[model samples]
Structures are given as structure tokens and as C-alpha cells.
Target: MAMGKTPGNRDDEGDEGVFAEINITPLTDIFLVLLIIFMVTSTVIVQQGPGGGAKAGLKVNLPKGGATDVTARSTDLSVAVLADGRYVLSGNVVTTDELKAAFDKARTENPETLVIVQADEGVPHGTVVQVMELAKKAGLAQLAIGVRDGE
Candidate 1:
């Protein structure tokens, strides 16, 4: 009897039994290729999403200016002004009245909180100013307007 062959199996040349071993090198190679393709495609898709150049909650064309780069601290807050005059605080849509409360709550938690306003280029100047004033009234002294670094 062969070590890995069926007892009743025999070949014309007297070689018997089942091969019993699976060749998986080809299957492994195919799977690895597929994994690489998926990784590349996923990265490309993410890179092409809204605010591809930077991480932003809403899609906004920032005003171009000679702005310096600023590192955001953990205590920093983000507020976005949509083109349609809507406000999005930290990715959540909020009304003008709610904006004050949100900023107040954030300020109470961290007195040194910094507010970064990210308003679309098409947004009215008055709207942006209103949000800034609200933030100030909320006791958040540190305020910063988000802009794309003209690097």
C-alpha cells in the first residue's frame, strides 16, 4: 500500500493511490493580486473625496490667501459654513441659535478651546461674521478662520 494512496487504486505504470496534497500556490498568488488591487483602488477613492487636499467635514472651496500653516490642537473646534448659508459644527448641522449653545458647551469643557471657522468661498461675509460673533459671545476667546495653506 502506498503511504497516501487508496488501496484499490493503481496506474498503468503501477503507481497507485490518491495524490492527497492540494497545490495552493496558484490560489494564493491570485488572492494576493486581488488584495493589492483592492488596496490601490480604495486609496484612490478616498483621496478623491470631498476636500481631497485636506480633511474637512463639508465640501468648501477655501479662500486663497497668503495664510500660514497652523497645527490644530485637541481642544480646537471646527465650524463649517455651507454655500447655502447653513452651518455645520463639527460635522453636525446646527442652526444659528444652536451654534451659540454648542460653542458654549465646548467652551465650558475647555476654557482654552479654539474655534476654527471653515466657510465656503461663496458664503456671505455677514454670515461668517455672525458665526464668529456668536463664538465670542459663547466665551470662546480663541478664534481662528480655517484657510487653505497657500504653500
Candidate 2:
């Protein structure tokens, strides 16, 4: 009889607002574990440097038979062919287009620059020719090859 609503019927907003609070304990634990792992791996990261990750301050004293007077010459460029025909030049694995670009840059710097090629022994000779051809196309005419000395 009263003007107020009936007891059974309720307003639409009777319940409190919906909420979602993420539990951060597990997340914090994961972050801490990752930090520890990185700290443990820092020693390995020290091995990388500009000289291509080569080790320094360590030497091996091996028995030497004799020394030869083959003077070491400077290289202006290099190329390589893997047994699977992978092509690499100037320390970078590159496509034919990239190889050409590198050769052009190297040749432009020094017209008489030497181009040294190092290929896997298992690779076919023809594959090496293809790399050399790319070098020639980019104006690198003076090319040298590296080989193993007889033991």
C-alpha cells in the first residue's frame, strides 16, 4: 500500500561494482627468477666483443718444428662457400645482391685491394667460381685464395 517498492523486487544496481584484481605474487616470483638466471649467465656474455668473439689473453705452447718466411699480406675483401653452397663475404652471410654491394664498397676504397677467398674443402670448385664472378662484377679484379698447407 505504501509508495515504496515491494520487498521482493529490487533495484538493478543492488550489487556492488564488478572488479578484477590480478594477484602479483606469482608474477613477482617469475621476475625474480629471471633476474637470477641473467646474473648467472653474465660470465658467458663477456666472451663477445668487436673482434668476432675471439678469445684473448690465452695462449697454447705447442711444439714448433720450423718457421717459414711467408710474409702475411693484408686483405681488402674475402668470400666463402660452404659445402651446402651457402655464400658468405667479408664476414657476412649475404645474398648475391648484398655480395655485389660489399665488393663495390671495398673496391672503391682501394682500387688495388686484394680479395681472399676461403671455401670449405667439401664444396665444389664451380661454386667458388660463382662467388668470384660476383666479385668481378663489382670491380674487384685482384683476388687471392687461401689454402691449407701440407702437414
Candidate 3:
């Protein structure tokens, strides 16, 4: 019997010793793959920021707000304010005058029309206020601001 070898344990040519050391290669590979997957998914989520409904191509980072139920209705007039100071009314890029005109038209068509302003987080407060003023001047009584849902 050799040193540290038992009598019943045969050291045959085909019998390798017990694999005491753990093979970390496969574990490391799995971790790297998972890391890659997470990286890709996180980038996609960041690129596709909040508020993608109604306006498909427009990207607006809305400010966080409390939980509220705000759903789209046929009488709702949706407007978007981009960070670059551009206004989009019903998915069409428009000037301030154009937006006011659209709002007036909608209000005339439906007295109960609601104006929803979806402004980016970087937009100036004055701009948002201007939009609200436009809605008010257009005689649209109901107005709402779009905001991201959070605590």
C-alpha cells in the first residue's frame, strides 16, 4: 500500500483520483454569459424610456408622480413637448400657433375634450405653463399632465 492510499482503493490505470478541486471555468463562463445578457437588456430598457403610448416615435422622460388612473379616450387631445422645445400635437410636429389651433378645433368639436400634456423632464416650467394656458384659452376645461408612475 502506498502512503495515504487505502488497501481497498485500487489505483488502476483507468481509475482517476476524486476530483477534489472545483472546476470554476464553467461557472465563470455562466456568470459572464449572464452578465452579457443583463447588459443588453438594461441598455434596451434605458433607450426605450417612459411614455411610448399614442406617440410611437416620440421619446419623453416624464417626471415621476403619484399613482393615478389616466387612460386615453376618444375625446382626449394628446400633446407632447420635446426637450428641444418642439411641440407635437397628436403625433404631428407643430408650432405654438398650430397647437393652439388644434386645441381650439378639438374644443369646438367636443365641449368635454380633455387636453393631456406630455412634457419631457428637461422641459422648462414656463413651457408647460404655456401649454396649460393654451388649453385654458381654447376653452378646454379638463386638463391633465402626463407623468411617470412612481411613489
Candidate 4:
């Protein structure tokens, strides 16, 4: 007989009707937890360097080294050996002949220019050596093999 009360329900006993409003406390808690998880994961990813601090278009798993960081000038040259048997001089893809030409040009401008060779872990030893030999032939006296920190 009471308004919003089911039939046969006793009026003497005070009983609230079915709850029409949704309880958002648990939903809000779940969302907050997910947000916290995303925040932590994103920070971790940002802190970790790609390829151990060597940023290049080509993916190269550099060998680990115990050597400390050496000072490099802005004019220093970087050569990357790709996994597909290709070469990257500075940031451009080039053939062996083209690489040699670039090296020659760089040497002409700066004879003491340092050449840093970065080769992927799966790259053949012969390929790396050939690159080094080309650098030497190009008149570059200072050559350094790039590697990730051992730590």
C-alpha cells in the first residue's frame, strides 16, 4: 500500500527500496590503480635508453665495453653497419663506394676527424673489418669501435 513498496511488504518493518543509483567508488578505485600502473611503466621506459644510449635509425646490438666514455667533438664521424649488410654513414644509407667517398671528403676537410664504427652484434666480423679498413684508407687516423656500457 505504501508508495514504491512491493505488494505484501509489511509497513511496520522499515525497509528501503532497491538502490537505483550506481556505486562508483569501486570503479573509481580501479581506474586510479590503472592510471598509477601506466604512470610507473611509462617512466621506466623513458629512463631506459634505446640500444644502450646509441640512437640510430638502424638497430644495432652493440658489444658491451668496460671502457669509459671518451670525449668526442661535434665534427666526429659515425658509421653504422646495418643487419642487412648495408652501411650507414652519419645518418644516410650508402654503398661501400659511397661510404668511401664520404670518408674521403670528410678527411679532406678534417684530417684528424675521428671515425666511430657501430656494428650490430649479428654482423659478420669481415664486414666490420672491411669498414674499418675503408676508414683507414680514407685517411682517418683516429678510429674507435662503438660499444654499449658493460654495466
Candidate 5:
């Protein structure tokens, strides 16, 4: 009678057990690549939309201007004037009184805060003036206008 060989011993059968451990290096590499691509594309879409405008709020067609780029700061307050005479403060649609109150609060928090008015090209000059006056009345001395870079 012949004796059976152990599992680890070399035998004439030349049989090896199934490979139970799975290699996940390739799978992990593929996932990382996909994640990187998604992150990059999302950033581009957020910064510059299909219209190539760096707008994070309401879509306003900024007029061309020769002014240089103004670096944004922490104390900067953004207000948007839509073509339909609506006011948007920091992305929220606000009434005139609410806008005034927001301006007052911002001024109280930081006397040197700068208000950047982003008005659509079709917005009337008078509407923009009213917003500016409100800001001034709120004691916000520093003010600026948002414009598209002249090309």
C-alpha cells in the first residue's frame, strides 16, 4: 500500500491549492485615478462655468472694463443687482430693507469692509446708485464694482 502525501509536500500529482488572496493594488490604483479626475473637473466647473464667468451666485453678465483685478479679502461683501431689479446679498435674494440691515451689520463688524456690487449689464444706473447709497449710509466707506476682465 502507498502512503498519501501531506498537502505541503511535493508529490507526483503536481497539484497546488487555489490562490485565496486577492491582489487589490490594481483596483486601488484605478479608484485613485478616477477620484483625481473627478476632483479636477469639479473644480474647473465651479470656478468657471460654461459661460466662462467666475460667478458663484446669480448669473449676471458683467460689463467689460479696463480696471485691473481686485484681490478679494475676508472682509469683502458681495451684492448682486439683477436685470429684473432684484437684489441678491451673498447669494440670497433679499429685499431692500434686508439688504440695508445686512450692510449695517457688516459695517458694524468691520468698519473697513469693502462692498463689491455686481450688477448686470442691463440693470439701470439708478438701481446701482441706490445700492451704493445704501452701503454708504451703512457707514461702509470702501466700495467697488464687479466687472469682467477686458479682453
Candidate 6:
């Protein structure tokens, strides 16, 4: 209140002077209330689980097409998009004309076949698109593009 009074000098006589120090009781009370509130709400947040983050809306699903005669190994077939917009399926460099034959033949064997495309990074974007279009037209539903992983 008044630093321990002035020794023998009684400024307020029997009365104690007003407290000049900040009363931290109210601050401590408020912080404790906030801490408890956060503790309760944090569990709710944790229970809600994690989301896909910024790519949440970018989720894509592979197509589910009709069952075919192709084996599961067909899923490992190579798809390459050439710089000249050629579609290569399983080592057979194909023009647009041969895509249907290759694709249908693959699909007719493996029902779970997926076409994963690996093209030169320097290749034209249209070439990649052409490969995807060809895969779709060939009755192969799942098309995944190969890319180098980032650091």
C-alpha cells in the first residue's frame, strides 16, 4: 500500500493508503478463464481431424470403367507423350490412329489398369494433353502424369 508506511510517521493515522501497485488478481483470473476455454475448445478442434490443406479442393478421382480382359500388369504399361505430340503406349510409338487399338487391347485385359504417363519436361503441353485424351478415348480411365518430385 504505502511501501510499509513511513516508519514512525503515520500519514493516514489508522487508515492505510490506497494501493499504487497493479492488482494482478483480475489479470490472472482472466488468463485462467481464457486458458480453460482454449483447453475445452482445442479438443473439439483436434477431433474435427485434419484437412487436405490448400489442395483440399484439388482432389481428383480416377475413373471406374467397365471390367475388361486386361491383366493387372497392364497397369504398369508405359505412356509417353513425345515432343511431336505422339502418344506412345507400352513401347509402341503410336499416332492418334493406333491409340484406340492399344488402349482397348490393354483395357480389355486388366480391369484395374491405369495409364501413367511420363513425358519429357520440355515436351509441349499439347502433347501431354493428347496423351491424356488418347488414354481416355482408349477406354483407359485412370491417367496419371509423371513428374519429378520437388525438394
76-124, model 3: which lDDT tens digit per residue?
9999999998999877899999988998899889989988899998999
Clash pairs, candidate 2, are none
- If both were scored by TM-score, which would come out higher, candidate 2 or candidate 5? 5
* Per-residue alpha-carbon lDDT of candidate 5 for residues 64-143, written as tens digits (9 for 90 to 100): 67566676698899999999999998778999999999999998899999999999989999999999999999999889
Candidate 1 residues 47-97, lDDT tens each? Answer: 788866446346766666555555688878899999999999777899988
Best by TM-score: 5
Model 4: pairs clashing at backbone N, Cα or C within 3 Å: none
CA deviation > 4 Å runs, candidate 4: 1-63
lDDT of model 6 at position 43: 66
1-151, model 6: which lDDT tens digit per residue?
Answer: 3454444555776754455566689899999999999987876665554453444445565344333523335255567777666677667777777776777878888755787777875798777787778778777787776655432
Q: Candidate 3: give its CA RMSD in angstroms.
A: 14.4
Give candidate 1's error at residue 125 in angstroms: 0.9
Question: For residues 90-134, could you state the per-residue lDDT of candidate 2 as single tens digits?
Answer: 566788788778888888888777777778879987888888887
Better candidate number, 1 or 4, judged by lDDT: 1
**CA-lDDT, candidates in order:** 0.83, 0.69, 0.82, 0.81, 0.85, 0.68
lDDT of 2 at 61: 47
Residue 26 accuracy (lDDT) in model 5? 88
Clashes of each: 1, 0, 0, 0, 0, 7
> What is the TM-score of candidate 4?
0.55
Model 3 global lDDT (CA atoms, 0 to 1):
0.82
- Pitting candidate 1 against candidate 2, the one with the higher lDDT is 1
The segments of candidate 3 whose C-alpha lies over 4 angstroms from its true place after superposition are 1-63, 66-68
| Selected candidate, larger TM-score, 2 vs 3 | 3
